[model samples]
Target: MSWKKSLLDWWGSAGYKKCSEKNRSVLKAAVSLMVVLFVLAIGVRAEKSVVIIDDGKELAVRTYAGTVADALAVKDIVLLNNDEVTPSLDSALVSGMAIRIDRATDVSISVDGRMLPVRTQCRVVGDLLNEAGVAPGPEDEVSPALNSAVTPGMNVVVARVVTKTEEKEAVVNFETEQKYTVNLPQGTTRIAEEGRNGTAQQIWKVKYKDGIEIARQLVSSKMIAPPVNQLVMVGSGLVVSRGGENIRYAEAIDMVASAYTHTGNNTSCGVAPHYGVAAVDPAFIPLWTKLYVEGYGYATALDVGGSIKGNRIDLFFESYNEAMRWGIRNVEVYRID
Candidate 1:
């Protein structure tokens, strides 16, 4: 106010009013030049803003534009398609206002063993997966958790989990059983009934990951078919054995047997008969061969008889009455070779 008023007062002075028009015009030009110089010295290149890149690099740019996009364009800063800008490009720019840009990256992802291509400007795995259009369930497992940071060439995997109960056919082994009987000869075995394999219907809870089985748990098992016990009868015959309980033999023959007495009788061996001697077929039991009569006592095959053909035998006793009582009976005689 004071300078303009002082200039106007000077212009209106008596000596100035009496001056020519050319002199007045020269004075006006000098005043305009002074004002222009003062404005330029105060405000030139002072209005600018700060821009920060993805890596935290800063750029100081001078621009007369009003918006963020215009400021970036004035500085020749180019942006990629996937890049992001904070405060938007059309936001108004003020002095010392900060601008930020985040560069995009290619993230690789594998969901349920399938590869997926995605691009994003996110920094963590959670954001990246969301951008890639993949979501994992509670039972599913992830190699890298959602909160894990994403980097270049990073690969993520998600495993699908499933559990189910399935019915299956399985086998239950049968047990072997043994029985002893005196009806059969010793040291021999007979399978009364042949053993057969059993069948069972089983239930199981199976777990799978990515369509592959991982674990199994038994839930309930019921026997659909019961196993039949095998029956085997073993011989425990009472036989003449100096070696206890071994009644095995090479061969046996079923024939009729008769009893005789000890006396000076002409026999096959041309010797006097004794109480423990027996006559048998020479082709069956050789002379002097030991013999054990069932329901009778031990004897020696010391003689042969012409009537003792095939499997016939004659056993000698101490008493004639005992021989008559023994009579004739069918017996299977074994030869101990």
Candidate 2:
């Protein structure tokens, strides 16, 4: 107030009234410019209103700084190497401007026998894999699930699972069947039908993990061809006439026959060796059993010999010359029931 009164008094003085109109106009213009400069200075120093979103948290800030970087610096917010910032740091600050910061997390991915270390801002595991350029197949197995939240230092594993169908062919064995008949000679057998092996197909489901087999299951089995059963005809018994006598027997055996004379040794059953007596293995024919020979006459089993085994018989002859003459022959033996 005192300065304004003094300046007004001097301007209205008689000496000052003598000034020219051009000088007065110059003075008025100078005062107006001074007032405008003061107003501009005040506007430049005014504070700006801004909002900072740091890791999903909103912070309302009134900053006197000029740029976004300067505003964050004022708040002592430091940016890391992997951190993401929007509305870049160099941009000029404006009233009500929004600055966002997305924090990155460190994680590791294990896939296809590889370890990949990465830093990402993705929150979900699936999104992190996508960002890392790792794609999982439909049948692949993933650890910690794709929808789970991503954590720091987490290790994600992907296992490749595969399933395959395998077909194999195998041989099917045939069965044998026996049929009894009295039409054929005793101890004789004939094949009525020949046995044949058939073919079969098997289907298996095999599962593999990382190129290694994990499980195998048989899914189906089908016969390609039915097997043929073998049919055999076996002789039960027969009646035959030898030396004008009819002999009915239960079983017959085709055996090798040899002749033996007296060796000054009695039979094992304490009987003197004589004609119509045969030496046989007790396992094949019991002692004192009735028997008939084809080339030789009927006889009884009264002795045993070490050389006489299965399907072999020793016929007794009265003389050495006769025993030599009947050296060895194949003959049919019949057991009377």
Identify the candidate with maximal lDDT.
2
TM-score for each predicted model, relative to the true structure: 0.47, 0.39
Model 1 C-alpha lDDT per residue in residues 1-337, reported as the tens digit of each score = 6887988888789978887899989988998998897776444434765654544787766666677888778777788757888879998776777788877776688886679876678899988877777888778887788899888778888888888899998887777777654556776888988777688888999999999999999888888777777888777554445436555443455779998786667667777777777898878777877655666656678887768887888988778999999899987676543
lDDT of 1: 0.76
Q: By summed lDDT, which 10 consecutive residues of candidate 1 come out lowest?
A: 242-251
Candidate of highest TM-score: 1
| lDDT by residue for model 2 (228-320), tens | 999987775668899889876656789899999989999998999999999999898888878888988788999999999988899999999
Candidate 2: Cα lDDT at 214: 94
Tell me how candidate 2 scores on lDDT: 0.87
lDDT per model, in order?
0.76, 0.87
- What candidate 1 gets wrong by more than 4 Å, as runs, is 1-50, 62-67, 70-82, 93-97, 121-124, 127-133, 171-192, 229-337
